[model samples]
Target: MSDSNTTDFTNPSTFILLGIPGLERAHVWISIPFCTMYTIAILGNFTILFTVKTDLSLHGPMYYFLCMLAITDLVVSTSILPKMLAIYWFNSREIDFSACLTQMYFIHCFSVMESGIFVAMALDRYVAICDPLRHSTILTNSVVAKIGLAVMLRSSLLALPFPFLASQWPYCRTNIIPQQYCIHMAMVKLACTDTRASSYYGLFVVFCVIGLDVFFIAVSYTQILRAIFSLSTKDARLKTFGTCSSHLCAILAFYIPCLFSALTHRFGHNVPLHFHVLIANVYLLMPPMLNPIIYGVRTKQIRDRLLRLFTHKGT
Candidate 1:
């Protein structure tokens, strides 16, 4: 259905996001905490980026992927959190149709990119562990750069259909999006016309991209575990698992809530609205907040280098 046929166009061009239920009425109270979180997330991710870029010792396949993950986190969080803050603090819930679409597009794009980055991280671990002899040769700087570019391209392409399909839908009188940000599923649900096609297409994209990415990550870790256990020395096994423990935690932190959110949206809508909103936000915001800290605390080289860099300026 064309926009001309579906939407009245004479109606409001912008929509109100109701946000979460109890919080909507208490926007003032919530804004302070939300803003603080946004600041910390941005600052933390930026520190990782800066630390990795300037410190020569930190420049390796692991840190390269860490930098990419930081960049992705920054972009993704910035896309959603600022607008959410504006809505809560200033009562600025009116988002233009085009702007809404743009927001939805980037949310999808960055999400896919993050998934790809996780897979890439897994691949790095796989090479470092399973193919130890050729780890450096296989994950050379040029190769890492190429993989990063390919991840970006793949994510962009995968998300292209969402906005294109969304643009064609005629958004009639129902313009109230319950969430703070323009979520793709919520937007499609708001459309007056049949949205089965778009919904199914989205599901397909999610399964194909997230599913394949998770599968590869699982396989990489499986092989990694095998290599770790095969080591004759118990200390060697501990050391190997130690190197991957942080990434494993990060992967769980990212994927668990994401899969829960997706599943709840698809099969568990009979579940409470607050349940969905809470899980969705957790999936979106928690990883960005946790990723840098995880890498900084768990990775010895990164931790030592970051400490040195921070202490050097003070001295």
Candidate 2:
């Protein structure tokens, strides 16, 4: 029903995210490995979730944080993996504008929430290790619940500006996004108008949120180390350190990649696309993939529960 000129002038309302352009010929080859990774990530995190939920022994603050982390991993992986698979397998890369926005919103929201949760977990560890007697009273169910709510609220509120800024930009005729997923920066770059305001605002938000979270986490861990060193008995120090080891590993894995990505985007924009894509994937996939394993290997109670469950199923 439209005229030829009108049709020619109007950009398509949807975008086909052809991932890593030249890699199209390798899609099938990459898909096999990618799909395998996705399955493992899902199953691994799901097992952690199930084990924690079913085992009453894990009802304390540590497992409570683990379960929340598993949920965040599930949400983050689900947000991007299915879409990536579809693009690689069926060549169905099309994503509507609204759907893209939704994906971007949730991805940022959950990521920020995860950062806050990590900080909370660090605090919980510090309290448990540095002040064991008061651990129970300090991180009670009501207190943790309140902290969880604050995490969700803060993440949602902080990430709200990104989508709002993105929505204001008019899309150009050339709308091919270069990555597998709907990243906010990529979307903003595709806009027809000048993006200085949005870019600066986003940079400010990223630094403020991630920077403060990391700072608090670092401070908490420093005090924990001091407390550990102060203990005269080697056994006491080892036990306390062991309890926090998994969380420390997970935190390092999650935050380093995120900080690197943010730094590259801010200061290393001149870097090659391949480097960018690699770091982005690390930011997107590494946390989800490593979270379950970190928790499983580090936490004895949850690990035992998972082993028993699997053993029973095998029989």
Candidate 3:
């Protein structure tokens, strides 16, 4: 190994995360809402998991996929948020290179998993609305299980190379990552080596997973709209629309900030660094907290179950 004393391209022993850069004086105030969101995300997602797992009436394929979504959101949120809170609260922003890489791996891995599950949920909605008679037969337990396994495998295998390729480069430069958590490009950009390949692969992964998923979702919704229009009664169409609004909100909450963040990062050179960092946190933090609440309040069955749980406790 090169001398640590030299300014050569040597890998860092530890990286200091500069959370929300110029907002150092306000980290205390910022932590209030972040802490609340984290707590709500944890508690809300657990409630969904528990409600779905224990309720016999929710044993359908739709609820099963919902449970899977809750699990994914839970894992992703847990992996990213606590560390962010630590940075905000205690100034605990130092992270080892290997540990940082590990965090990056899981963040990318679970993000892809979350996207895959979104596609799966879209497919479920498609089948249920477009082909009601076959929905049950098509999305049986075995089929859902098989699809879940494929989703997990695809994300895990594809995202495996991100951290590996990032770690391949030597990091002789300063070790201050200007974000709350270790992200793919942010960490990779610190290397004093060629990172064009990492950038290209990041885009490739985005297209392969989220791009493809969004296309299929659009097709599914097209068919769904046709199916809804074919119905004679307005009430039927309205009811059908209501069943899907929650998922639509969930999708927007997940993807809109993500797309915006990516765009600003690539092209918004004049954009403030604090804005970029805020958006990164929004996309990662908002979806997990919002999803469960969206489903719990919007879906009548889950709402009823939640009410029953609270009512029983009250009694």
Candidate 4:
């Protein structure tokens, strides 16, 4: 009974969310940047979605995958930011325990889905460039739908265990989560129980989702480069590489900060807490903010349409 009492801080009614520990005095000021980021992400993603849906010329598999990406970005950004803003502006950080788990589930699910979309987009580029003749036949509307459904299922199933495992542990430590949002690792750390299972499972998911995605994306790009070099005409090579530039930039934007954040969380014990928090924020927020810009700048079709839309409206 004493041991039980000692270990079990079970069924915590609420948990406090620490927005930024070292910068609590400045959360009001920090919200300015956060608000700007949220605005850009929403507007950018919505524009992409609107452009893809309205433009019949963009009905190809590539754009179909891109539409899915835009939707995912919108859903992900919305899932994390509202309550976060509430914390910063209203000091409403005392979230119900159940609400935190729900947030974690969505955050994890959407992140995996986004990664899956990236892999799918890479494959789309590979076929479009490397096997242009068969691209249409291979990536029909039906196949694209299947890919979307499969990714959704994979992300949902894989992330389910995360919150389940978290809820199983009795929370003896402080119930304050040390991040802007309900991150899986941050929640897991507050549990007094042994975290070996959660750690290994998290690693397993990362390998299966992120590691495999990186490997396949790398292979697809390698084959694509080989195909481009083998092209007889410079014009043909330039066109093919140009088609891939937007996706490649988005990939770098999404992965680099994420890798750094993951490395810091695991190995950088001496790293400042604020630095870790900020890096994680970049990983969570930057890709959604930048992907639309990358696509708009690199893809002539998107840029031309956007410019024409604005020009027509101005007149």
* TM-score, every prediction: 0.94, 0.93, 0.96, 0.96
How far in Å is the alpha carbon of 19 misplaced in model 1? Answer: 1.5
lDDT of 2 by residue, 204-228 (tens): 7678888899999999999999999
The global C-alpha lDDT for each of the candidates, from Candidate 1 onward, is 0.86, 0.84, 0.87, 0.88
Worst ten in a row by lDDT for model 3: 2-11
Residue-level lDDT tens digits of model 4 in 1-315 = 356446345778888889988899899998888789989999998998888887888888888888888888888888888987998899988888888899899988998999999999999999988888999999999999999999999999999999899889888778888887887889878988898989888878776679888999999999999999999999988988999999999999998887788778888999999889888888888888998989988989888888988899999
Displacement of residue 29 (Cα, Å) in model 4 is: 1.6
Which residue pairs collide, candidate 3? 10-172
Over 4 Å off, model 4: 1-8
> After superposition on all CA atoms, what RMSD does each candidate show versus the true structure?
3.2, 2.5, 1.9, 2.2
> Which candidate comes out best when scored by TM-score?
3
Colliding residue pairs in candidate 4? none
| lDDT (tens digit, per residue) of candidate 3 on 46-121 | 9998999889999987788888888888888888788888898889999888889888988889888888888888
* Ranked candidates (lDDT, high to low): 4, 3, 1, 2
How does model 4 fare in lDDT?
0.88
The alpha-carbon deviation from the true structure for residue 108 of candidate 3, after best TM-score superposition, in angstroms, is 1.0
Question: After superposition, which runs of candidate 2 have C-alpha atoms over 4 Å from their true positions?
Answer: 1-12
Model 2: residue 205 alpha-carbon error in angstroms: 2.6
| Candidate 4 TM-score over all chains jointly | 0.96
Candidate 4 all-Cα RMSD: 2.2
